[model samples]
Each structure stands twice: as C-alpha cells, then as structure tokens.
Target: MPGALPYWRLSGFYFCYFALLGATAPFLALYFDYLEFSPARIGELIAITMLMRCVAPNVWGWLGDYTGRRLAIVRFGAVCTLISFAGIFISKSYAWLALVMALHAFFWHAVLPQFEVITLAHLREQAAKYSQIRLWGSIGFIVAVVGLGQLFEHLSLAAYPLAIVLIMAAICISSFWVPDAQPRHRPEFAGQGRFIEQLKRPQILGFYLSVSLMQLSNGPYYTFLSVHLEALGYARGAIGGFWALGVLAEIVLFMFMAQLLARFSLRRVLLASFLITAVRWVLLGNLADHVVVLIIAQLMHAATFGSFHAASIHFVQRSFGDRQQGQGQALYAALAGVGGALGALYSGYSWSTLGSSWTFTLASVAVLAGAAVIATCLKEERP
Candidate 1:
C-alpha cells in the first residue's frame, strides 16, 4: 500500500534465509546418515539445532525491542550464523557437529523473529500484503530443495555444509539492504496490560500450545522424510522433488492468502489446517509407498505450514502492542522450537524401533490434539 515500501529488499532477505532452510530441512539428516551416524544421533543433532530456537529468539528479541535496533540485531545474527556454521567444515565427530549445530542455530534462529517484526513494521497498514512478501521464501525453498537435490545426485553429501554457508552469507548481505521501520504505537491497545499478563490468557496459551504441537508433528517429516523416502526406494532427486512440490503448493497458498483470510476467520483457517495436517501424517505413515498418496500428503503442506504460519503471524501482529511485537514473534518461534525438539527427539528414538508407520501415526495423534485446542480455545476472529 505504501509507495515507498522496500518490497524486493524485504523479499530478498526472506528468499536467502529460507533457501538455507530448503537445503537443511530436507537434507541435513541425510548428511548425518552419510557420516554413518545412527538415527538417534541424527535426531539429537537436529534437536540440538532446534532447541536453540527456544532461547535465542527471546534473547535477541528483548535486545532489539529495548534498543530499538531490530535491523542491527538481524544483521549481527546473520553474520554470527555464517561464521559459526563454518565450523562444520572442521570436524565430523558427533560432539563437534552438535556444538556446531547449537552455536550456529542460536544465532540463526535469532534472525527470523526480529526480522518478522521488521517486515510487519514495513507493511504497516497493508498487513494483508504480508503473504505476498512471504511467498518468496517458499520460492526460495523450492529453488534450494530442487537444486540441491540434483547437486547431491552428482556431488557428495559433504557439499551440504558449504551450500548452507553460502546461503548464510547471502542472508547477511541482504539484511543490510532493507531499511528498518518502527511499529506505530496504538493508544487503544495500551490498556491491554503487560505482556506477561497477556500470555496468561486462555486463548494465547491455547494458541501457543497448539503451535508447539503442530511443530512437534512436523519433527518426523523434517528430520526423516528424505531418509524415509530414500529407504522406500526413491532416488535423491525425486525426494527433493517431493519436498519442492510441497513448497510449490505453499507458494500457491501464499499467493491467495490475503483473499483467503478475508473470507474465513483465522480460527476456522487454523482449525482446518490442523485437521488436514492430521490426515496428512496418517497418509505419509501408512501409504507413503504409494506415489499418489505421497503426493497428496506433500500437497497438504499448504495447510500444515503455509496457512498455519500465515495465520499465526497475523495472530501475533493483532495480539501484541507496538512495544511487544518482537517478543510476541520471539515467543511464537520459541514455542515452535520447543515442540520441534520434542518431536525430533521422540521420532528419532522411535524411527528404528517402532517403524516409520507408527512414528508418523504418533505425529498424527499430536496434530489432532492441536486441532482440539484450536477448536475449543481460539475464537472466530477476522484478520
């Protein structure tokens, strides 16, 4: 809506940032497996990376909010992430890798929540346009997943760390190009009380609990979906295509999200996403051997991640005051991290013993529980 909006600059940062995710989320576990690490070890390493999100965002968020320097924090975090992640090139030992994951992720996780605050500040009154900017992240993800899949087909999995480092460098560079914007304080929301007090509200607690559960459900998919498909006799390139397909669907969802939100309440959208995600996990668990079933499951990522994420961002923006925006987004990231860590830990331990089918079924159960929370606690509200 604003003529001076730095749309491409904002979108570029998201592109580079999520491009790194595209490489890591689908392939990181496979890289660990290439090192001959056990399933539990791979899970532990991934969990270590995720666990940092629980702390990193909140710390950086506070500093950004207190200092009024959100962009500076984003830039600093990006550089630190790139520097720390380079440690992966030094050692392949489990201890070394775990330390590397934790250090890099601590800084890496710090970037997004603060950047989210920045993005929304830039959008100002045209908040509905948020999805248009965010869709580039999905495109970036698609590019990385498909490109790296083909690259890994020709190159060694050892190339994974290098790919991530280059992408981090891009994220660091992109951060500088986007100018910062401050959230406009709204007097009407001032009476909403302290941030901690708001957090205690049933709806807020329920929303966060549901966020954790949704991510917890995603743990298996992110941690092992590539490995699982590889075991099912699919080629690495095809596996990448499957991941890309899901993001492609996510991109499509983002394109229409402004209109979608206009017609439906956030509660209805979120509840539907949770329910569809439940069925998706079930299909992936039981019938992944069927290409058609696998395709359908992957497509559900539109709901599982795309819609859920867009809705969650809108919710945070609406719920918090100008001063609390960074923290609101930080807490959202932190809770998702908590759920993700639990999911990764449990799925890793269960993957070999309980079998893939059962592991995903467990994921399905977690999502259904999230759905129940949404159905009962979140009220119907237009975004």
Candidate 2:
C-alpha cells in the first residue's frame, strides 16, 4: 500500500460530492420557501428525493459489484444526475419539481455509496485513515455553505441552480480522474462467510438499524433547520454560519478520528454520539434564539455526524468483504435513505402544525431509541 492514497483524487470526489450537498442541503428549503410551497409540500418534494436514495443505491451497488466497475458506475450516475437535474430550470410547478427531484436524486444518491466502496478499497488495510480523507468533504462543505450563504444573501436563490450545476460538473470531472477501486483479477479476501450470511448476525443487523434511526433523527435538522432559523429572524449568512459551525466541529473531530477509534470501542463511541444527539436536538428545539445555546448544539456535530459516520463506515468495512463491497455500502446508504426520507416527510408534515419545538423533540426521541438499540445489541469485536 505504499504511495497508495490517491489523496487529492479521492478527496476531490468527496469535496465536490459534499460541495453539492452544501449547496443544496442547507438552502433547498429556503429555495422552496422562496417558491412559496407549504411546509408539507416542501417535505414532499424533499421526500421524493430521499425516497430515490432507498432504491437507487442498491440497484447501482449491485451492478457495480457484479461488473467490477465501481468508478464507471460513479461516472454514469454523475453524468445522468446533472442531466436529470437540468429539468429544474424548465419549471417550478409542484409536479415538475417533484419529477426533477426524483429523477436527479436517483442518480445523485447512487454515486456516493459506490464511491464509499471505492474509497475503502483504496484505503486497503489502512482504513483508519479514512477520516483524514473524508475531512476534505467537511472542508468543502464549510466553504460552500459559507460562500454560498454570502452569495445568496446578496443575490437571489435563482443563482442556486447555476452554482449546483458548476459543482456537479466538478463531480463529473473528478470521477474521470479516479481509477477503479480494485482490479477485477484480484479476488476478495474479506472473510470466511458470504456477505449475505453476515446479515444474519445480530450485531450486523443492529448496527444497520441503529444507523437508520440516527439518520431519521436528522430529518428536521437537514430539512427544516434553515427555515426554522429564518422564521426566528436569522440572516442567511448567519444561518450558513451555524451550518458551518457544525461542520467545523466535524472537521476537528475528523482530524483526530483515527486516534479516537484506536482508543475507544465502537460501541462506546456510538452510544455517546447517540445520547449526545438526543441532547443536541433538545437544545436546538428549545434554544434557537440564544446564540450561545445554538453554538453548543452545533458543536455536537462532531458526535452526531463525525464520530457516528466514522464508526458506521468501519463497521460496514468490517462486515462486508471485497466481493460484497458495493452492496454493503449500498445497504448502508439505502437504510439511511429510508430514515432520511421519513424524517424529511414527517418533519415537513408536522413543522407548521406541531411547530419546531415539538418537531425537534420528536427527533430527540428517535435518537434515544437508536441509543437503546445499540446498548442492547452492538457487540465487541473478537480478538
């Protein structure tokens, strides 16, 4: 594995991948609000995109595994995502937007899961260093959120599609630069059992289920935090600042994640992340007006996303061998899709009716439920 890390190549993919996220995730709701869609309708639109995630990743992941063309899948998905997303420029009607979201998201969501498989395979035995590479994504996210925040502040969100188009183009270009994760001739040496059999283990199922629950808890934060903050009267740049703050915390944690994983048990890391997530949601739900309270809650991103994601990636890497790599990452993405769609769908339906306080309280409850599952079922790895 000497000189192994195609650091910039892999990091560029992550950078552009999350840069697109930075453009869309924190701001899409604002764009919807700009279009005057009701909260429920906004949720529906976001949900359509998320629902695509549940299906597309597994379909593409399976294809990649069967064909051993992980990078090819990434490129095709990227190219088509950009093409499908072009539909956004043609109409703002509910039906039109819904169709565009679904079509583009189908291909967009397909890219990351397979890319994850490529990334880990590239890491070879040095998987612990994943956080370092992944941190570039956080940096890209921070830059996009803050920069785009300022841009949209001065200009209309009408500029958003163009910004995203450019970012998508960068994603397409980055895909061309990376090689296939593993050579077709090299047979997998992951473990003794077939990948499907690994699913029968309680630990494996429990971990996957826990991740979905955690992602479900993130629904409000991802879907409505912008609108919620805006309704509270924060400016767009300030709102972006809050989003950046969380990822900033994430960046710091990612820098040290290798050492943290070395010292802490995965179960311990996950349990702490989940419990703290419960607290963070409660604070965000109740304390948005207070900048200090908001900062504290944002700081929790280290646990909520950084530590939890690192642990989850390692778990999947450990679970699936070389042969099932694509599907393994795909399953993780698919389950997360299930959780995220429900989160966005439910939060959208409830936000105006139930209100932000209650919406996030429900989120808190979901995370605690995940913590309960992990405590009972996550197993220690055998020596």
Candidate 3:
C-alpha cells in the first residue's frame, strides 16, 4: 500500500479518523440530548475533550520528538484510543462520559500532529498535493455524517457511540497500514535558537494568533450549531447536508491550495481567511433564518477554514524549520485547543441562557479581536 497513490493512502487514514469524528461531532450532543443530559453536563463533557486536546498533544509531541519515534507513538496512541473509547460503551452517566471523552481525546489528539509531521515528511517535495490527500477526510466526514444522520432518523440514538467505535477501529487498522516516514533534519537550523525564540518571531506569532482566533470562533459552531439548526426546524438530514457542504467547499479549496500558496504570501492567505471567518460567523448569527444566506455563509468555509489551515501549516513549516516542527505543531494544537475548549464551555452557557444568536455574535467578536492582533503585531519576513 505504500506504493499506492499518496493521496489515497494517506487520506484513507484521515478518512477513518475524521469519519469517527463525523459520527460523533454531528450527533454526540444530540445523543446526549436524548439521554436527557443537562445542557451544562453536555457542555462540560465536550469542554473536557477539548481541554484534553490542550494537555495531551504537548506531552505526546515532546515524547515523539525527544525519542525520534513519531510513528511508534502514533501507533501506540491509536491502540490507547481504541481501548479508551470502549469505556463509553459501558457507561452513560455524565461523570463517566467525561472520563471517557478525556481518555479517548488524549490518545486521539496525540496522533494527528505527529501524523502531520509524517505527512509533511512524505510531501516535502510536492506539498501542493496536500488537498488531494486531505480531501478524503472531507469525504469520510460526509459519509459518516450523512449515513448516520439517516440512521438516527430511523434507529435509536443509543447506537451513536458504537458508530464512533467502529469508525475508530477502521482508523486504527488503516493507521497500522500507513507507511512510517520520518522528517529530514534541517542542518542549517541544527542549533540556531531556543524554542521560545522561534515562537516569538513575527510571522509565526501572527499566524498562531490568527488561527487561534479562527478556531475560537468555531467553538459555537462546533458545539451548538446543530442544536441551533434543529431549533430552527432544520431536519437532521438537512443539517448534516449543511455540515457536509462546508467540508465540500473545503475540498474545493484544498484542490487548488498548493497553487494558491505558491502564488501568494502565507500572510496574505492567512489574512483573507480571518476576514472571511469574521464574515461567516456574523452572517450565521444574524441571517441564519434565511436559507440562502446561511448557504452562502457555509460556502465561505472553503476560505475560512481550508485556506486558513493550509496557510497556517505552511507558516509553521517556514517559521520553525525541521527541528521545531514538533513544538510548532504542538503550540498550534495547544493554543487552539485551549481556545476551542473555552469557546465550547462558554458557548454552552451562552446557548442555554443567552440564546444562539448572541453566542455566535460573541464568537464573531473574538475573530475581530484576533484579526486586529494579527494586523498590528504580525510581520512576515521573506525567507
């Protein structure tokens, strides 16, 4: 399989990973809703998962980097994820659910940044092919979300956790088949700077702040957009369709992102993503009642998420060089993880008390603040 097309092989793994998320992301809250978990309990559960994202990846990345054993770490993590997720099958109470989400997320989040290290190692010569590789994740997400959406329309929501377990098993199996690739060491920066100094550079700082804000704004959408849509009378299938549409737009953007990055500065691409995100959120908050407007807002996800993420990864590669790749990716995961966790926790409170519109409006405000910080403080020096 290593001789297979790179995109198909790499993306097949991601398809499994995110297919698991697609099953969980769209309907986990809804399942909890069925179980009559209080809004606060639901928020805590999701927030804890994101919180684990904040803590686990750093420790795991450091281990991978220190030992130079990234693939081994990834495989170990997959095994742990498979075992930990089974915890959910036996327990349904809020406290038990929190423990399960925390454990699974610790291992699940541990794998991606390291996988990213491996992906970049393989694609160093033809980085433009990232979208071709990554688009399968969108495809996987669509399959799981759409398939399970219809399933839930007819079957019991109790089956949702099992759906995630099955998909994760596929992820672990695919992961085992993924070829092990190690990043080439950069001799030029072999001993150049401290991790703190690399982090303080203008362009890197700006990109991190910008994306942290972007993911922060996504808090409300990831946490409650489905609930909000359901409240507005959007059927489950239509809601999944809307979610899938955002990723489809993401697929289109990924198709051409390599060219876009080659032609434009990462700073420019990053800035455009931030502006569009601000627009997307505000539109979602105020115009969600209008289907056409909402669809337009969703389409902007191509730029808001796809372009932003591609550019952010590029900036990290440029900013940190080979030596700090682990740290760079970990920092991205950390800041975004903490921000996303806060966003989910806060939005849960906001969603329950203040309402969805106000909650999303606040998220847009966070984006605006992030954009301002990037504009004022982030300076890009040509390499």
Candidate 4:
C-alpha cells in the first residue's frame, strides 16, 4: 500500500454514499406504496430518478475532465444532491414527487462517477485494491438496510425521506475531507485515438452493453422486491434483513476481490457473474416463498453485484487513458442509469400485469442476454 493513501477518507466517502443507497433501494418503492401509489406510478417515480443518470454523469464528467476538478465537482454535487432531495418532504403528489426525484437524482448521479475517478486516482498503482476500499460501501449499505428496516418496523414509513436526508448530509460532510488526486496519463494508449474512438471499439461497446443489461436485469429486484416480499407476508424488518443479506454477501466478495482479480481475467469474472445472476433471478422469482431458497439467491448477490461491479470499474480504468478517466467512468454510470431506468419502467408495468414471478423471469432473460453478449463480444483480459 502507498504510504500516502488516504484510505480511511476514501473509504468513508464510499460508506456514506452507499449507505444512502441502502436506505433508498430497499424502501423507496415501499414508501411510495405506503403513500398509496400504484405499481406503475412507483416505477415511474423511480425511473425519473434513474433517467437523470443518463444525462447528469456525462455533463459532470466533461466539466471534471476539462477543469481537472473532479473532487470539487464531487463536493458540489454532494451538496446539491442533499438540497434537492430535501424537496421530497414538500409533496406526496406524483407530479411533485417525480419532479423532486429528477431534481435530486441529477446531482446524486453526478457524484459517484466523478468520485470513482477520484478514488482510482488516489489508488494509482494499487488499483486492484479498489475493492478493499469499496467494500466499506457494502458495509454502509448493510448498516442502513438492516438498521432502518428494524427502525421502520417500529416507526412509520413516513420517516424514510428524513433518514435518507441525514445520510446524504453525512455524504456531503465526508466529501470535503478527501483531497484530490489527478490521474497519471499513460502515453501507451494515446494511439488508441480520442475518447470517441476508444468508445467505438468493439470490446468497449460490448462491455458497456452488458453493463446496461445487467442493471436492466436488476430492475425488478431494486424497484419492487420489498413490495413483493410484503405481499408474500413478510414483515418490513424481514424485508430489510433480506436486503442486508444481499449486501452482506457483496461485502464478503469485496474482501476477496483483489485475490479474485489477480487469479481470474475480467472477462471470466464478468461472464461468471452474469451467469450466476441469471440463476439468481430465477430463484428469486420462483422460490422467494421458501426461506432457504431465498437465502441462496441473496447470497448470489456476491456474484451479481459485487464481482460484476469491481470488474467493470477495473475495465474502465484499463481501457481509457487518464485524460478520459472522468468520461469513461461517466459513460459507465450513464449506461448503468440507462439500463436501470428501463428496468424500473418495465418491472413496474410487468409487476402488476404479469405478476411477480413472471416479472423476475423477464429479469432472468435479460441477464442471460447480457451473458451471451459477454461470451461472444468480450475477449479475455486479466485485471
């Protein structure tokens, strides 16, 4: 490890950032349902937030790359995100909530991709150790999901926005403690041409497409799993427990990710993650009524999110030059947002019309398609 690594500060930022996600992902849809929103309306509300990801990251990435002020951008975005999200407390109407979701998500989406660039810049030569720091995010997620689940069980779902706002405040405070680091430009990849040309390459395009599909498959899980579990007679606390179980599995994967990356090629890791994710969706859709089966499915999150995400980050770092790092990470986030929006929309419609089992079946099909793309288009490359 580098002597100068701001390890705790970097990890602290991830912890707080994802802790917000922990609060949001499991309960946001549930909160909407609590307010008597229809499944489609809930999906639309979530999609609005996701749709911002399609635009915000690119706009912020360009500014960060151009100004070489990635950390400053992260700080600004963090503050804006907190301010914008606080608008949720203003109204419960669909239109009003939709506006708030879009407003907050634009800035919220901007923070992570630029922060990713900052974290990687800080890591420098110890890039494979990225998972070591990122695992704190999983821990944060676990804490938020489990703790909030228990809390919400006792209190009202009305408190959801307030809990998230407090976590966002922590995110805002943490961003300031981390100092900035610029990416070291590598000339060897300069011949690959500009960012546009690099993106046009077959492998890069395939990798991104797979990323979108993976997120798309995750749509049903993120947008409605709590609702689905609730309808199946699980309590709010158990729903949170299930969500925490998935992140617990993710945290375990992160702990070993450096060793896994050293031993396995990124393509292999991704392919395996996709394949296992397909199975996971199948299990989630079909056997969620069975506690043991559900446990197995949740554990598969280690592959579905943890391994897939770590590999994707490493891929962007290797494929783009320092000059393009911000854009590269932004594009990754943008594509993910694209996939997530589609996932949320489709799952919302399908959940009510097709039923939970069929909706998850569709998610599995999406993951299978992503796996096929990986197998056919991506070549083996060690991280």
Candidate 5:
C-alpha cells in the first residue's frame, strides 16, 4: 500500500519547494540589510509576498476545483514563479525588489495550497502518511539553511539569488512527477455555498482567527530573527544552525506526529503550541545573545510550527470534503497571508521605532491572546 502511493514524488515536491523557502526566509531580510534598506522598508517588501497570497491562492483554488486540473495549476504557478524570481538578479533598487517580490510570491504562494488538495486526494485513506512525506520538507529546509549558512560565511551573499533560482528549477521539474487528483463528485454539491457555511461556524472562525494571529506573531521570527541575532554579533553559521535546530526539532516531531495525535486532543495540542509560542517570542526578544536561552527557545519550534501546523492540517482535512478541499485550503492559506502581511508590516515598523524587546514582547502578548481565544472559543474539537 505504501509502495502504491506516490510517496517519493510528493516528498520530492515538498523537498524542493521548502528548499526554496529555506533559501529565502532566513536570509532575505539580511539581504535587505545588505542593501541598506530601513526596517520599515524591509517589512513592506516581505509583506508584499504575503499580500499576494491573500489573493492568488483563492483564484488558483477556484480554477482547480472547477477544472480538476490542480497539477496543471501547480506546474503553471511554479514556472511563473521561476520567471518572476529571475527578475531578482537583474534589479537592486527598492522599487524593483518590491515589484519582483510581489510578482513571484503571487505565483509561488498559489502552488502549495492546491498541492495540498492533491496530496490529500492521493492519501485519501491513509492521510496520516502526510507527516511522513512532509518531514522531507523539513530535511530540505535544514540542508539549505545549514549549507547556505556555511557557504555565505566563505563567500559574499551575492550567491543567494542563484541558489534560489536553482531550487525553483528543481521545484518545476518535480511538478511533472505527480498526477492530478480526481475528486469524487457529490450530488448535494448543487446546493452550493458549503464552504461559506463551514466558515460561519463559531469554532471554525475562532480556529482561523487564532491560527492567523499565530502566523502574525511569527512574522518577526520568520522575517527578522536572523538579522536580530546578527545585530547581536552571532556568526552567520551559528544563526543558520539556530534556524536548523528548530526545524530539526520539527522533523523529530513529525516522525512521531501520529503517536502524538493518537494520544492528545487537537485542542490540547493547539493550546500547547500557542502557549509555547508565546514563551519562544519572549525568550528571543529578551535574550538574543544568550546561547542557552536561544537553544531552549529554538526547541519550542516543535510546538509553534510543528505541532500547531500538524493539528491545523488535520482540522482542515476533517472539516472539508473532497469537492470543497481546494477552496478550504486556499482559505486557510489566505488567512495566514492576511495575518503574516499585517504582522510583518507592524513588526517592521515596531522593530525600528519600538526596539526589539518591546516588539517581541508585543508578539508574545498576541500569542497569549490567541491562546485565550482558543481556550474559550474552540470547544468542539476532540481530535
């Protein structure tokens, strides 16, 4: 049965795609710094990517659901992403960089949510295998963060654009390896508006709000922790290792995700993630140069991203059926974009105007609010 699944193909796509994230996420802000951009400007640039996600995924998801050509959409998104990102190498001005970021991200963000529809369609019966395939993404991230960190130490970061381009190429090649999903049609679908109904549920609304805030809270970590640590005098390799440690913990958690899900309620897992995320922001903000504190906070990624994301994925899968899957995932991604874009914008402004300690303390408070919302509003969840 495992052999029958398109395991390697699915895994390879994740590997290549996340490797692209690895190429950019930890280093891009630093690259902005290298170009002498201000904190607010950098945040705006980062926000451009998330801002595109707010629109692109929905447009693509609707196309996939109506046409049943999710893989074709994935391939098209990937190719366009490559074409748009190539502009990065040609431009260095603030306006040029911002334009490219928006263009490529619109296409890049469109791919993953629909691909989620495809992967879940393939794993229709054995969805738990998702963590197994997804772990390779963590592995890819770890490899890129760690290897690129070392490489940048020896060479100027001028090499960064080329690395991203190559990863984009790999993602394009991997797209051809998987087949499209054939969703089982239902007669009740004629009534329409099923997704809108699902969104109206109080608990569902709370879940999306909480998750959006969680990502909003993460804007600093994803967009600025490397720059923050570097400002405090950490070596590039050390910073990369710090990022890798978090994902390594995430990988270990993925390996046992099924067992964790079996024993714990989804609310419990999500609550823990929210609580721990609050703690991580606090530590990162207060003790940047403290290696021991940093390590402890890094370990918390298992809960912040790992457990929280796994639990959210299961919730989405449980909530939406085959016919509605694409839109459902696209909605999930879209909300995250809304939150991330806002977070990045505010965090960027706050980082320069308010200082690191206050900025992250604010992030911690936001996570606390999310936890409280979950505790009170998310009562229906048992899994």
Candidate 6:
C-alpha cells in the first residue's frame, strides 16, 4: 500500500507473535492450576521458559547477522516452536510440561528480536509508522485475552493446548507472507568495532544495565500479577479488562510516540519512564484495592513500557545504524532476556513467600536503581 504496509502482508505475523504471548501470559498460571501443579511448580516452569530466551535469542541473532539471512532463522525457530508445543499436548506430567515449555520458549523467543530487525528494515525513513503496524498485534492480544477468558469460564482447561496450537499455526502461516528486507551495511558504524567495544561505551552499557533492572522489576508483573489480581476477587473478565486497558494505553502511546520522541530527547524519555515505573509498581503494590488508583497505575503502562520501549529502539537505531543492527538488537534481547529470567525466578519465590506488596516494593526499588543508572550514564550525545 502507499505508506501503510498492507495488513494482509505484515499484520498477521505480528498478530501471531503477540497472540502467543497473550495466551501464555494471562492463562499459563490457570493452566498450571488445572494440572494440579503447585504454585512453586508453576513458577519454576515459567522461569525456565524465560531462561531459554537468554540464550536462544542471542544464538539466533548471531546466525542471522553472520549469514545475513534473518528470515531463515525466524522460519526455522517458528517450526521448532510448533514441534515443541505439540509435546505439551501429548503429556500432562510436570516434567513433560517443563521440557515442553523450555523447548518451545527457546524457539519462540528467537523469532522476535529478529522480527524487530526486520520491522526496522522495512520502516526505513518512516519508522513513525511502527505503531500503526504494531497496534494490530495489540488488537490480537486483546482478542485472545477477552475471547479466551469467556471461553475458559465455560470450557474445560483442556482447551488450552488446542487454542495455543491453532494460534501458533496462524503464526507459521503468516510467517510465509512476511516481507524480508535486508539492511544495507554502513561502514561508519561498523568499522573497527568489536562487540566488546560496543558494550564498553558508557551510554550503551548504562542503557543496557538500566533497562535490565527495569525488566527485572517487571518479573513479578509478568509472573504473578494475574494471580495476585485473581486473589483480590477480580474475575477473569476484569483481569482481562485490566490487561486490555494497559495495552490500549500502550497503543495510544505508540500512536503518538513519534511526535513525543521528536519533542523529547531519548534520555529525557527514558528518565521519565523509569520514574513513572517506580511509581506505577509502588501503586500496584499498595493501592490495587482502589479502583481509581488501579486504573491510574494501568495507564502508566504507556510511560513504563510503550515509551521506554520506543526510546530504547530509537536509541539502538541511532547509535548502531544499519551495519550493527542485528548485533544491537541481539544485545538488547540478551540483557532483557537474562534480566527477565532472573526477575521471574526471584519474583516467583518472593511472591509466594514474601507476598505481593513486598515483592512489588522490591520491584519498585529495582526500577529506581535503573533510573539512577540512566540519569548518570545515558547521555545526549551519540558515541
């Protein structure tokens, strides 16, 4: 199409990637509950899945950058994910489920960072269109969460595997139609730069560390927020609504994000996001009972996730340019992957033993630390 990518051409793939996440994030705990798995067992299963992202994304990134064949790696990863997810359907045991979870996550996580590189490539000078493209994925998430919430209330938990399989199949089919554009390497950004050199840049290191801590803080939300909300007498529909609200806010943020960034420096945006995250978690910890406060906290997803993510990607694109895009994207995924894994594991333990308030309070502290690092290290000048 003229300026917009034909949704028929690209939206389906984004839909598949995010739709799988929607199913897993909101309902995985409930799925574990149905299998009679204990809280700890569920935590461990989810932690292992996050752990796989740490290694898999980097591995896939390396292969893609080295071969200059990003799409091939994505296609392979998707097929592997499908095969592994099938293993979950065949077995009901915790051991089998854990293996399935880890295996599928390894492959599933590999696809996204590469897809990000692909999206950036396609965006060219019109990166502002990212939200319009990405919003469809948010729509997919809303559809999965709302539709499946009602479905699960009536249907048995046995439907989980079938739902997952069908969504994954959609992803695979969509992958076939995704346009793969190769980024032209820019020597200025590439020459004499080892990965370690890139890592050693003060702004780069600071940005990575700051985002790592912020994501670490998010561990509790990704792992236990749904369970916590459910415990507070929020029905599945309400919880789904709450989750949908956050994404809706995120969609709004994405829509205005280009203008926001043009008006604000990246460091300023990152700084604000970190501070808002600190407040959002603290509120989520102490004020979830107050509907008004909860809605406000949910709205902060715009700053905490959508703004921060756009700023990070913008920083990467500005800093690394075309030549190092793959590696830059991989490094972001690596830090986030590792941080998220540890955060999920720790949050699982803390949520069960220390309780939600203390867990989220600690999460708030983590974000504050990230904010401090960014304030000190991320700079106005690109290296």
TM-score of 2: 0.96
| Per-residue accuracy of model 2 over 172-221 as CA lDDT, tens digit each | 99999987777222345545576678888898899889989998999999
Q: After superposition, how far is residue 277 of candidate 5 from its true place, in Å?
A: 0.4
Model 2 CA deviation exceeding 4 Å by range: 183-194
RMSD of each: 0.8, 1.8, 1.9, 0.9, 1.6, 1.9
For 179-274, candidate 4 gives per-residue lDDT tens digits of 999999898877788799888889999999999999999999999999989988999999999999999999999999999998999999999999
Candidate 3 accuracy as TM-score: 0.95
Ranked by lDDT, top first: 1, 4, 2, 5, 6, 3
lDDT of 1 by residue, 1-383 (tens): 46699999999999999999999999999999999999999999999988999999999888887898999999999999999999988999999999999999999999999999999999998898899999999999999999999999999997888889889989999999999999989787799887889999999999999999999999999999999999999999999999999999999999999999999999999999999999999999889989999999999999999999999999999889998899999999999999999999999999979989999999999999999999999987754
Worst 10 residues of 4 by lDDT: 374-383
RMSD of 1: 0.8
State the lDDT at 376 in candidate 1: 94
User: Residue 184 lDDT in model 3?
Assistant: 80
Candidate 6 stretches with Cα past 4 Å from truth are 1-8, 381-383
How many residue pairs clash per model? 0, 0, 0, 0, 0, 0
The CA lDDT of each predicted structure is 0.94, 0.90, 0.81, 0.94, 0.89, 0.83
lDDT of 5 by residue, 289-309 (tens): 899999999999999989998
lDDT for position 221 in model 4: 95
Tens-digit lDDT track for model 3 on 1-383?
Answer: 24543656688888887788788777888888889987777777888888988998889878877787888888888889989989987878888888899999999889888888888888876666776787788889889888988887888888887888888889888888888777787777777687787777676677677667777888888887788788889988888888888888998998888788778777677777778888888888778889999899889989877888777777676666675687778778877888888888988898889888888889988888888877777675442
Q: Give TM-scores for every candidate, taking all chains together and pairing residue i with residue i.
A: 0.99, 0.96, 0.95, 0.99, 0.96, 0.95
Clashes of 2: 0
